[model samples]
Target: MKEVPASGAFRQLEPGPIVLVTTSYRGKPNIMTMGFHMMIQHAPPLIGCVIGPWDHSYSALRATGECVIAIPTIDLAETVVDIGNCSGDTVDKFERFGLTQQPAGSVAAPLIKECLANIECRVVDVVEHHSLFILEAERLWIDNDHREWRTLHHRGDGVFAADGNVLDLCDRMVKWRHFPR
Candidate 1:
């Protein structure tokens, strides 16, 4: 075994598809690219996402307490980077990136039309010091035709990896048959 630095471990160890977090305040909508996110629970679907206080979308997210986390496939890699490169403070990301905004079922934040999936969420809790927002997923929408879509994951800096290959471990793992459908 080899030793590695602990401080920057998350750079490469972080997992999950890069997502577009859309939040709306009043009648204005904003979208931001997010990579630091994870699912915290299964039942009722809880998610945890970190949005730094400095981010332009922070205020809107905090005030509204709702957002749409959209999962974009690798086909949107370039546009994802472009959205992340600019601040939503002075830019309308949807128009700037040529993205389509579709109304969400349970949230004011709009779903990104081109994404593979969109999860509508409402903030259930917040950890101010950490800028950690715990969300309850209220609704979900997915592109059935993109069932085989590959999603992009950020690998620190400007690098990213597209999901590839699949391993089935269901047989060796505990089944969720007891869980509600």
Candidate 2:
């Protein structure tokens, strides 16, 4: 491990899978690709994610305090990257990508029909200094019929990794069994 720039530390510590966050404001719905997000709590199903002022979805989230986190599978790798490459301010991502939009139960933000799972969330807190939004899951929708289950992970730059073979260690999770599934 040779000396590398400290700025590149995030590449090694990237958290969780890349997801699409949707927000609707003034009857216009928008989707943004998010790679910086993590689970913060379990009881209330809280999630912390970075959606800075630079992002088009930021204003909508700030005003509405709601959004949907859609987890896409490996098959959408190219589409996911393409979504992030453009700005929602100029483009209607849902129509541009031909992605089906399904109405969410708890939030005005629509869910991507192609994704593996969609979590409707409401902002519970905002850490303005860090551009962090703490969201509480209001509802969850999963596609049990969708065959693709592998999710994508961003490794900084243009690199990404997809979920691979499962290492079933359920028997070894004695201490974590009490945690919710």
Q: Estimate each model's TM-score.
A: 0.94, 0.95
**In candidate 2, which residue pairs get closer than 3 Å at backbone N, Cα or C atoms, i.e. clash?**
none
Candidate 1: which pairs clash?
none
Alpha-carbon lDDT of model 2: 0.93
Q: Highest TM-score, which number?
A: 2
TM-score for candidate 1, residues paired by index: 0.94
Candidate 1 weakest lDDT stretch, 10 residues:
172-181
**Candidate 2, residues 27-112: lDDT per residue as tens digits?**
99999999889889998899999998998899999999999999999999999999989988899999999999999997899999
User: Number of clashes in every candidate structure?
Assistant: 0, 0
Off by over 4 Å in 1: 179-181
| Highest-scoring model, lDDT | 2
- The C-alpha local distance difference test score for the whole of candidate 1 amounts to 0.90
Q: Residue 52: error of model 2 in Å?
A: 1.6
